[model samples]
Target: MSTISAQAALLPTFSEVQKAHRRSDVLILDRHGELIHELRVDKTGRRLEWTKLKDVSPALVKAVLQSEDRRFYEHGGVDWKAVGAALIDRFFGSKTRGASTISMQVAVMVQRGGRPLGHKTFRQKWDQMAAARELEKSWKKDEILEAYLNLVSFRSELQGIAAASRGLFGKEPSGLDLKESCTLAALIRSPNALPAVVGQRAALLAQSLSPGEPGEAYRRTAIDALSRPYRLRPYLALAPQVAKILTAGAGQGELSAQTINSTLDLRLQRFALQSLRQQLDLLQGRHVGNGAVLVVDNATGNILAYVGNSGDSQVDGIVAKRQAGSTLKPFLYGLALEKRLLTTASVLDDTPLHISTERGIYMPHDYDHRPRGPVTVRTALSASLNIPAVRTQLLVGTEPFADRLRRVGFDLRRSAEFYGFSLALGTADVSLKELVNAYRCIARGGIVSPLHLTPGHSGRTLRAMDPKVAYLVSDILSDPGSRSVTFGLDNPLTTRYWTAVKTGTSKDMRDNWCIGFSRRYTVGVWVGNLSGDPMWNVSGVSGAAPVWLEVMNYLHGNVRSAPPPRPRGVVAARVPAGHGEAERGELFLAGTEPPSVPAARPAGEAWHIARIAYPPDGTIIVIDPDIPEPNQRVFFETENEAPGLKWRLNGELLPPGEEGRRWAPRVGRYELALVDNGGKVQDAVSFEVRGQNQ
Candidate 1:
């Protein structure tokens, strides 16, 4: 008796055993406690959450007792009558069978590194029996039975009643019927036994349970239950990407908790996924294969919907870094406004620009390839003019702008010198999550915070930009008239309610992004091929904008999206027509409004502002091998041409022509100057002609 007590002290308590069990999979639930996904974390064995004694089906408990040990309730730990019969048969009878009560089985299960019940020797049997009696003294009958059901293996890879019932019958343990229960109880004896053998044992158990019932009926039912293969039904995979992200590095402690609640709204997640998939279907012919959608509550910065992919690939597009096209324009313009370097009424030249860089002369062009000349900051930003954006980047400085983007959570992963002027055109790579959260910051009046996926998890917020500047940028994006220069009046961007939105298309049409925000929600969508294949003529408006529009519309179906109130330090001022623009009221920072707008140039004032048109500032002329040296001529053209503007090449005055002047090809560096009638150089451009002169 003292030895038995010592053995029981070595074993774990019932509560301790329950606490140590870890489910193989983690359940992800939505904000309202709806199961969204289940991700397997443990690879060794498939054990679900331990089933409690009360939750187990009464029919299953009865079947297990009848099949494994008939006097389970009456015996203290070992069935002495069955044990005596087994001992008598072992020595004198032709057949031998062993009697191990449920308590004894559970005792072996709770013992540290206990051997299998089938292969135990005489000494091991005596120890197991002694431990069983000790366990009965410390653990209640119900505790022993519950531990047995959970610790015993019912089949390959399935270690608990919860896993077995769900794997074999596609239902919870409480929902198990009599025949199903009998089938599972039979698996306890010979786990990997043939289905026919299990069925025969199950039939006998069922017959003993219902002695008045027809034996053949029970046999058929048990056979039907065991004949077919069983597997756990596929989990509710509504948020597989979220599950993957949340379950990363989930150790045994986290797995023991079994379920994690996320801040995702199931209804919104479903809608966003449907919207993305539907948009991908329409763009199928254009080679657009995958896309992602993310929705956030602007106030809390909680991620409401995160559709990582369009069901075609495993890549999580929400966090995948892709080249950010013109999507970063708003922030660039916002930074400029915040620094008081530019205002909404300030005019920016959107014409072709050539700026010298470390690599070479970088040229920026608009999406339409036709420069609109000088445009207001509002129109330039709303229209997404690349040249104006580059000019703005020059004003804000590349390093400062990149730092601002970093403050808003963009992982640029490189120095500003690496990106250069192209940073204004969004040459830097950024993730959709980062992009959406940045937009949410704008929606929240320039305060940037980390987006949360799980409830009660939030990070500190930082002031990324002035609220007044954010308000100004948002107002410009919401204005349909300002964007009409690029996008027409009626489009997916023009919502019935007010919304601030932008679209971006990366170089080669590889990525399309549409990010926007109403008053309460910010929605971002990305459409492209995850395999990095460029789509066929697919722009952001046609690819990602529609999905954004659908989700935004659904989100604001019953809610109002009125324009945000103008923040302090921002005021509306009247501006007269100037710089090829019409007279209108524009928003500007206080004390920065211009007293008078510059007047438009008079008609036919060609000689007033003379600048070279052809072979722009840092031109590189490559001599074609196929063309004759004399036939290859470079046009010496000047904008605002006048009668006295002569073309001077290499400090030598060229002969003036009736129509236009032309220079013959030469393998040398030449400086062409536009000299006025007074012999004063108005504009000069240095160009190099390279090739074999022949």
Candidate 2:
């Protein structure tokens, strides 16, 4: 009796055992508590969350008791009647029968370094019996039964009732019927036995549970239950990428908590996944394999939907860094607008431009390879013109633009000189999450904040850009009439409601992106190959825009997406026709509004400013070796041809004739100047011809 008291004092309490059990997987739940994904973090034996006594099905409890211990409720810890009967059977019968109560099994399971049931020595058996008696005295009957159900190993790598029932039957323990409960209870006795043997034991247990039922019917049901394949079906699994992210460094306490409530909406996540898959299917045979989509709430910056990849690869596309195409143009133009360097109606030359950089000469061209001559900032941005964007990058300075991108969320670790003028064209690599959040900053009126995946988790917000500038950029992006230069009026970018959208295709069509925002949500989509292979003829408008449009339309199905109200410091003004744009109302900064007087000049009288059109400054004209020197002509053309304009080569006057405007190729450095009849230089450019005359 003293030894029993000592053993009981040494045993751990029920709460201690419950707290020590750790599951191998963590359950990620939606905001509404619906399971989204089940991620297995622990690679050891599979153990699910602890199943409470009250949560366990009554049928399962009765079945387990009937199979393991018939007098479970009647015995203190060990049934002396069954033990004595087993002893008598060992002496007289051919086979041996053993009796180990639920309390006894719980004692062995919870004991530190305790031997397994069949392998225990005689001394260990005595100790186990003594511990069982002590455990029954200190813990409740229900506690012992619950611990037994959880700590018992039912099958291979399956430890606990939760794992067994879910792995074998694909349902919760509470949903287990009589036959299913019997089948699971039979696993406790011979976990590694053949399925047919386990099935026979389950049939016997079922027959005992239902006395009047036919024995053969029970046998058939139990056999069918055991014959089916066993697999642990994941619950929901709508957000595998999110689950992987959240459980990256979780501690034991977090993993044991079982359910992590996230800010993801189940409906939106499902729809976004479906939409991305459908778009990738449509782009079949174009070498397009993977894509991702992200949707955020503009008000709170909560990530509503995140699809990492389109089932093509295991890589998470949401965080994968890819070259950002024209998507970064908005922020560049926004900075220019904020600094008052450019306005919506300000004219930007869309013609060829050559700028010297550390790497080499950088030449920017429009998407269609046809320049629109002179266009307003509104038209330049809306049409996604590359030359205008690169020129704007020059005005904003590459360092300042790169700094602006970093302030938002882009992970641009390189120096400004590394990105150079191409930064405006999104030459820097960025992830979908970073890009979407940056756009969300614009949607939130220029205030940048961290996106939250868990509810109630938020970070500080910073004013990345002025609200006025953000509003102006949004207004320009929403105007389809201005975007008609590139995407045309009728396209996927045009939604029924008001949405400011931009599409970008990276160099060599390796990546395509379509990001936009409605009044309530910001949606971003990317389509390309995850292997870094270029897509075949796939553009942003045709590849990613359709998915963006579908998601935007669904989000606004019941809600109206009205245009954002104009903020202060922005005023609309009527501008006279100039720079190839008709007279129209344009938004401008308060002090930068155009003067009321028309700026247009009379035609054919130097109405347009003349700039060297052909052989842009710093051009290296290479003479083809196969062609004769006289046949190779480098034409000198001005932006606006006037009556009195003359061409001067190497400071020498050229005769006024069309043939004189075309100079024969020569291996020498030359400076070409565009001068008026008064010999006043209007525009000049330098070029070097290199090659041996053939």
Candidate 3:
């Protein structure tokens, strides 16, 4: 009755211990089945790998049995005395105590990770304890140890000893010195707060160790630790940032875990973290701080990395909502294009605008608060234009726009107040998770996959946007530059890597953002802080971009690059600048609201590039065999001929072209064009005037 030896009552028979060891012991094989991050992550969060336990120093087991529960061998999952004490504590003490056996604790630690260590009712607790007892009756003690080791969280994402030892101490579980063993064991209680730093806690652990010998017990612990030290590496996934999805993946329903296949590339994840940390170290005032990043396998909707807004603290690494800033443009623009409200070729004034909403009058401008007029959709997107995007959002209709965004995996309702004009500029409260998936819709050519942690929804398909529209938006996104600005260029660059990119800035210079895609993947970066303080002038381009570029450059290394899929549904037109009534003629051109682009009138009704023969950005072309140049209209090529409902040859109209049919061009680059089968007399692509090989 006087159970001084608590662990003694709990010890299972040798056969039982052997069987428990087998059931609880799980060998964690990496993607390659190479033992990497091993764990017993359910019960107490002790990270121990099963494979090497028998070979490694067994003294720790002896010590654990001696220290925590001497009655471990004789009792079931719970000793009635311990349970009663825990019950008494709950009813009388300020803090409750855990009354679990090595097996039950292992179950909790390995399977449950970290959650409250109690049950809602006595019956529920007793039932679970009973199950643990039943399992222990049939299993072995070592099995329980294996389970505990695997489930325990050693500091960060490290689950088993294998991961913890490597991630934290930078050594294997088997390599622990006595001090380290004592340190690690003490950590089982509070990994976040080091015992050395937290005086009282360290004292308690050091006291428990009571190694006996002034230095001998410690030496014994160390020697035993190194008997069979671990060797495998660790797994550190950068985890993708699909906040809502991953939130669910983590399961609010219950702490009970189910296998969740992640898109994380462990190697790339570590590299990204290293890259961002490096960038932060080089910033101004030594102030570069908190940030979140996401990487997606665009085609597969698999989130490769979810680096949350990390700071000096725990790095929570997966969930943080900072103002997205211009990172929201791709959605706005994609919505516009999808709704048929605008085309990549549509023009808008990037100057400030004053509007009276039901709430109040809203005025908007650019990052530098500068005014730019008559910019094309392509330019607006590339430059991360503020005014133009808002106007386009308005044209697309805010509620509809927001609804479309919601459909594509963004939850705007959570931060409706943060929306409005600036919302188009990313004022909404969103974590990297939300934006990553939304942006992924564009990259995935309009498909979306909500993050899933459990076995359910594996490889399941979830549709959020139209593929055609997604493709078009993705095309514009790839250019990063949007071709709105004119520069001295020899020729329009093909995707060089089928990539689309955009940069963003938040109010008060608090955030910088860069989101883009390659044919194979999509990456998003956000740099800012938790306090919502300014980051000086860290615009997306300057602050977040460098990091994004670094990660992307690595992701694409050695991979075959493909061009962004071409978009359809746009045409060519001709009209003088300030000459026509639509598209900002002299009235608006001189200093007023430019006249809106007039609705399509009957064709032959001229609408020109307004300015002749310009190299429009995002121009794509397919070359053809030689064809005789337009009936000798300048010794025309015997090369190719332009054909399409509306394919442009440098703002010039192409002859009616066929579909699903390849077109041979006049040995030059052609603006992949479209025709609005919607109406309009004749919307056609203008034939190219500047004949260049690129």
Better of 1 and 2 by lDDT: 1
Question: In the order shown, what is each candidate's alpha-carbon RMSD?
Answer: 17.7, 16.9, 13.8
**Over 4 Å off, model 1:** 7-20, 52-59, 93-95, 113-118, 134-143, 175-179, 196-200, 203-230, 252-256, 355-361, 578-582, 596-694
> What is the lDDT of every predicted structure here?
0.84, 0.83, 0.55
Worst 10 residues of 3 by lDDT: 584-593
lDDT per residue for candidate 2 within 200-254, as digits (tens), equals: 7887888788876555655666566567667887666888889888888875444
Best by lDDT: 1
lDDT head-to-head 2 vs 3, winner: 2
lDDT for each residue of candidate 3 in 1-694, tens digit (9 for 90 to 100): 2222332344444344323332112332223323222223244333333435664345445445544565787786677788788878878864876576666665443333333264447665654565566557655766666655544554544455666565545666666654555545545556565333423333344456563335444444433433334343424223323223433423222333322344455676667778887788777563567776778776656556656655435354345666778777777877776666676666788777988988888988876677777877766876667889889877876667667767776766554444766678778766666776677667766777775332224465567766655665665554422333421112122223456677777777877777777777778887877666787756665688788878887887788656543333322223233311222211111111223443332322322211111223333433333645432232112111222233344554455434222344455544433322221111112235344444
Write the residue-wise lDDT of candidate 1 on 298-381 in tens digits: 988888998999794668999999999999999999999888899888889988899997788999898889998889998899
Query: Clash number for every model?
Result: 0, 0, 102
- Name the lDDT of candidate 2: 0.83
TM-score for each of the candidates: 0.78, 0.77, 0.55
Model 3 lDDT on a 0 to 1 scale: 0.55
